[model samples]
Target: MPVIEVDGLVKRYRDVTAVDDVSLHVEQGQIYALLGLNGAGKTTLIRMLLGMITPTAGSVSVLGAAVTAGARSAWARTGYLVEAPVAYPELTVRENLELVRRLRRLPGGTDEVIERLALAPYAERRARTLSLGNLQRLALAKALIHAPDLLILDEPVNGLDPAGVVEIRTLLAGLAHQHGTTVLLSSHLLAEVARLATRIGILHHGRLLAEQHADQLDQHRRRHLHLGTRDDTAAERVLQAHGYHPHPAPGGGLQLTDEHALARPDQVATVLVQAGVPPTRLLTEEEDLEAYFLRIVGADHG
Candidate 1:
């Protein structure tokens, strides 16, 4: 059974429809990423899933339990960090986590998560003294203190540096792979999400435009062969004679999107060289997550 499920979920605020008939499911041990631009309703959808807000239509289920406001049973096994991290100004890092533990009725324990999130160095420091990155780490520590089965995070890496980003990425991967924790997160970081998530869902204008496996992302994106030769005219002729449809690249090079040509670039090089117009450069380029995202969004708008 799926770990989290949403069916025909919709959220409306007066005249604006924040979420429009959205539906998705996250399986156990899967890192599901919801990607979107600003005002794409990602946060709204997450709020509904967490039972922070009631959906205008449809329903949400987590761990086989329906999500409703003030429902503590379903939330016991869930951890979340929404928008920005906040902490008591006067409390130390350890004190903050200890307070959360008590509130959750969890047994006495704050050291494990402090070490897990690399917050031990600042354990005695006041929350107000922590940097943005360390503050994020502290929030994550709270989420993980209970060792919850599912995690829902929004912009979890907002204040993290490069190294911190990688650290959290590895941590999340380990959680899903080794501990069978299901994760559902929303972020504008497309490339980062591409690297970490097992499945991806694209949201635009309050609607889910596409959903696909991370491994299959490249398959859905465009790829092309870029070729540069000493003699452009001769190279074009050579390519035409070989029945390859080549188009002019932005920088006066020839480009071909034919799958056969991309797969057999060496053959194209041989053909060009034999024709006395040896290629100066031959390479294959595939669209990255950002470009793929723009293309999809543009196509939808067009």
Candidate 2:
């Protein structure tokens, strides 16, 4: 069995279908990111997986055990931090971690977990007194307290400063690499997920649109040349002449696909020059995971 498996998982809330027949697998020692906008059912699906809520239909199994109501033991082997974070505001950072250790019956290693998350600097500070970034670090420390085999984090870096984002990213990478923790990370930050996730699953309107290896997703949206000239009409004409369909760009540039399109950028430069257009700038734009997601899920809202 895979580390985590969702088979036709379905969850409904009142008149709305929060999760609709979704299914995916998370293997051991891999970071799988679930990418989606708000209300895309990612949270609901996560809740079902953690056994916090039961699916209206379908099933979820983690570590070969079915996820059902009151299955606290199943989740005992897992660690998690939800999007908004759940921490004891009055308790100090170290106190919160100590609580988690005792709750999990861990062998008194809160210090090691705090060190792993780099939370020693503010260990004695009240959770409510810490900044947003520091609070996030404390939350992560709590999650790692038991040294779980599986880690589930939703928006782990949300509201963090640039340095905080990098710190969290590095910490998660270390956990996955050094400790061999299988992670299920959910986020709307496609760029961050692309950097850390081994595989990605795109969710749209409570349904999964696509799943692919991070490298494959990157390759699909490879860099292409964007040609901007004095005359948009003439530039489009020239690119079309070369069997290139120019994707529309907001900042007044004709977007083309493939690195091969710009293999001889000088050729297009010459064409524009001969046509008396005088090429303004030739920029290469690499396709990122966000670009691939927008392409697959589209830019329009339902």
Candidate that scores best on lDDT = 1
Question: RMSD in angstroms, candidate 1?
Answer: 1.9
Model 1 TM-score, 2 decimals: 0.95
Q: Write the per-residue lDDT of candidate 2 for residues 139-253, one digit (tens) a residue.
A: 7787777778999998888778988888888878888899889999899888889888999999988888899998776557757788787788887887677666777677787
- How many Å off is the CA of 53 in candidate 1? 1.1
Task: Show model 1 residue runs off by greater than 4 Å.
Answer: 299-302
Per-residue CA lDDT of model 1 for 1-302, tens digit only, reads: 89999999999999999999999999999999999988899999999989999999998999999898777787889999988898998999999999999999998689889988989999999999999999999999988989999999998998999999999999999999999999999998889999999999999888999999999898998999998987888899989999899989987899999878988999999888888999999999988778899787674344
Best by TM-score: 1
In terms of lDDT, model 1 sits at 0.92
C-alpha positional error of residue 287 in candidate 2 after TM-score superposition, expressed in Å? 4.4
